[model samples]
Target: MAKYLIKSDATIKAAKPKPAPYRLFDGDGLYLLIRPDGKKWWRLDYTIAGKRKTISIGVYPSTGLSLARDKAKGARALVAANTDPSDARKAAKVKQAEANEAERRVAEGIPLENSFEAVARAWYAKKSSSWVPSHGDKIIRRLERDLFPWLGARPIGEIKPPEILAAVRRIEARGAIETAHRALTNCGQVFRFAVAEGHIESDPTRDLRGALEPVKGGHMAAITEPAKVAELLRAIDAYRGSLIVRCALQLAPLVFVRPGELRKAEWAHIDLDAKEWRFTVTKTDTGHIVPLAPRAVEILREVQALTGRGRYVFPSARTSERPMSDNAILAAMRRMGIAKEEMTGHGFRAMARTILDEVLHFDAHLIEHQLAHAVKDPNGRAYNRTAHLEQRHLMMRLWAGYLETIKAGANVVPLHGRAAA
Candidate 1:
């Protein structure tokens, strides 16, 4: 019997020096406990495993005798029904907390204010999970500077094709037709990423295929003429800037990779001792192998002595953590008096593409493999290139010899445009 309820006018009792368990009004089935030294607490009298169990509900007076009595009755019910009230209560609270958190996130997220720019960072973190590190910064930066400013905060679900089209119109308006197209692509990718992550219901940029204006210009010309190329190489050898400029000049002609690919070269990707460069991930956003040409090896070896300690091979001169400015090599060429008509940084790929096909007579697949084209294997699957090393090794040596001979101005002639011919 427990004296949980003290009837009016019941004689008030003083606790002895030693702690004793007391019951609320006789037979009330609730208990109050005082410790051996007057410390107090409430305990629910119960039974478990066929043995008596006393679960602490709370302290009396603080919890108050009435609350302790009610709590005791609840625990006693669990004992009678063969359940644990404490465990049940904890599980119930946990479930309620989870529900509350979900509700909070929903309450905070209005598809409008939680716009593309606002949530891009968290979205990028999710997107970058499977992406290679170098590509993460490139794609995100392009979006932040180009797309987010215009369309980021609009409720992604509410974003219409025309609304997206209008955003891209601003990019084209800035003389960035190619950039506008790329911005559209990026916009589509982000929305898709958002949709996949449950941030939005649909991608709005999908319908704007030809909505952005087309580029008016043609491809830049590559310089391969012995006299012109030699003049350019001669100028690069003397111009004063980062030693990386000289190294890039050598690697650019020898490897003939795109400017973007060359800039993101990471140490883990290149193995100079093995005379091979393995981009565990390639410029096409796929895995690629680069068989280091002798000149390519030599150039890397030199650049290594200067910047081996850094992450990017051609780290931006302005900032060690950044890649070399996309315009660094072209600017150097311009400084050496080479007009945009005479050559461009990207022109090196065209030069190699032409010479490797016409003069050297290399297989197109082998050439494309070296150039890191999005070449595919038999089932129309993305080709994982074992970069035609044996053939490339031979071709690269020959190409280096050919360039040297060109630099010496032997058997050299200026090129005429294909239409001119």
Candidate 2:
């Protein structure tokens, strides 16, 4: 039993290829295999559990005689411990791969794939496309600010309802009862997503019903009184801000669409000739048609002269590629000395809902339909976009005329259901 038989580098290099594969033994189950293709490979032959096995150590010159011997020594040690050298090598490779994956995830600020944060992020990425940008932003921000800090690192499957309640309690403690409820709802959506993806057994949020404080008076402040509404309209008409923002403010009450929808209005969706603004309502994922009143069309036409060729009807001042900031109209109102307690961008909806029903005396269903709400029919089916097109068009025209009369400081009396055409 000669040991280190092919010792020197010179002898190893001198060993030429053979007609068939042949080995040069170096004792202790280590050998150099020379093939007919003129390639040399280091191999280790060992027996584990009375079964013979061979594993590759390295190649010829690059591995060198010394390095191959070191690798062989390690393999032999594993074999002595009743482990198969080939199996040990495979297990080590797998362990190294797992370590690399973890390191990469950490570097990217991504939690473990099965963690609550990771699954929630995955859900957000999947669903946010259908949501308005502001709404999507709120969901991710809520998760990061309220829930991620506490439960993000925990495995999604191991999280219980109590842990979720504890995280939402922090949001409640800050007096954001509405936001706390919203955070809980968002978490439920994420958990249900996890359940569908097989990351968790069930949604834990379903277990914690009625656990938080009820939201007290979450309505946006609005001026529903006719006199105050007239003053607001006059102020909006005289807004000394950018023409684009002023138009948005003036149109807000007339059309009464959501602020996000107004700012993100695209030129492609507006048809002045048809006197309609068509867009997908992101909240309900439904197609919506806003039959532009004569006044609303006039406002759009005036702004169209400035932004006709762009993607957005009212683009951001800094860049035309995007819409105006969500805060643009609100900021303009604040600049005009309208406090948040007095009015907000969203307050227009409440204002219109009240005025259209109270003073104008329009059909409640038509008002709700015009508001793009989920108005159902007699059979419990939801009304389509153009359910009462003729009446709505007439209603919008009258509503615009009424606003003009009030803004002129005319003493206007309520139509009291006489205005519905």
Candidate 3:
């Protein structure tokens, strides 16, 4: 028989709480502690490094006899290995907590390498710094609105081409054909990024080529002929609309920016004395300088007298707090009998691009730089937004003068690398 102070369950059951607490030792540092209040607990007493300590195993009869002995045995093993049993128990609890957390994460569908939302968000964080605020918002919106519902929790490594195709087709079904194409391209970029990072074996988008409808590319309608451009200029001068709308129409051909950029022009961005309009280009997220010609500057100065106290140079008719509607210029053109097939507000950009390069014979690179068309230098470096400022300043003035001549119905005259006379 094992040596013990109390050897039988009958003896423990027959004992009752007394006026003081006492122990019934089973053996080898294990005992039953009975309190004056009738509570009994299991405990282990041991000595380490010349000091004595105690560890609570549990309360009984909840702990039971055989289970208490097993716990005591495990604690003794720790003490024999020169580890404090209390410290060992604490370490086990910490380890168990970590295991529980990992299991919960698995049950919640989180993983180490394959979550599409995880990888996509990482990629967005890496790239959003170089993009405009609006552009970044659009990227996140595209994923949340169109892709996340279907594939966010799916593993990037396990996502096949069929899943990607289905997500894109759903967007196409909503009549967002252009958005569908853009979403697929974005997916391709993300998949390629994952492959390069070794998170996936290959891009699933590679197998999806030619599965979408081919986009038919067409140019924005513009009056490219010299006579037709002259007529358009004449019509703009004769437009009897709101003062702000007429002014915007007159300035459109001179600056020839995208319609949104022109309409959203703020008084804060223009400097009349400096003869410059400096603002961030919405499409590229880079600073762009529109060197104001005398004619363009005059138009701005006039509009400032009316709207200088407000934020936008062209405030909407409904409220001065907002910029004019994007369709303001286009609607004005229609009212003037310039059909949509003949011209649009965006047509000014094409008109200037064609006339500057083909009619006036200016350097194509100079014209492209002025158009903010992402031109590269001879060294293949991206041109700074302010690059070629001197050339652009002279080009704006000459272009304005050429428009005046065309408005006068003169023959197609080339500037011939000289200032317009």
The candidate scoring highest on TM-score is 2
Alpha-carbon lDDT of model 3? 0.86
Per-model TM-score, in order, reads 0.60, 0.72, 0.64
> How high is the CA lDDT of each candidate model?
0.71, 0.89, 0.86
Q: Per-residue lDDT tens digits of candidate 2, residues 291-325?
A: 88999999999999999989998899999999999
Give the Cα error of residue 11 in candidate 3, in Å. 23
The numbered model that scores best in lDDT is 2
Tens-digit lDDT string for candidate 3 (45-158): 998878999999999788877888999999888888999999988999988986786577678866333578778888888988877566689988998889878888787999
Residue-level lDDT tens digits of model 1 in 87-198 = 7778889889866765675588533335676566667777686775666877787777777777776656667888778887887898878778877887787788878878
Clashing pairs in 1: 2-24, 3-23, 3-24, 3-25, 4-24, 4-25, 116-152
Higher-ranked by lDDT: 1 or 2: 2
Candidate 2's error at 20, in angstroms? Answer: 28
Error of 2 at 25 (Å): 36
Clashing pairs in 2: none
C-alpha root-mean-square deviation, candidate 1: 10.3
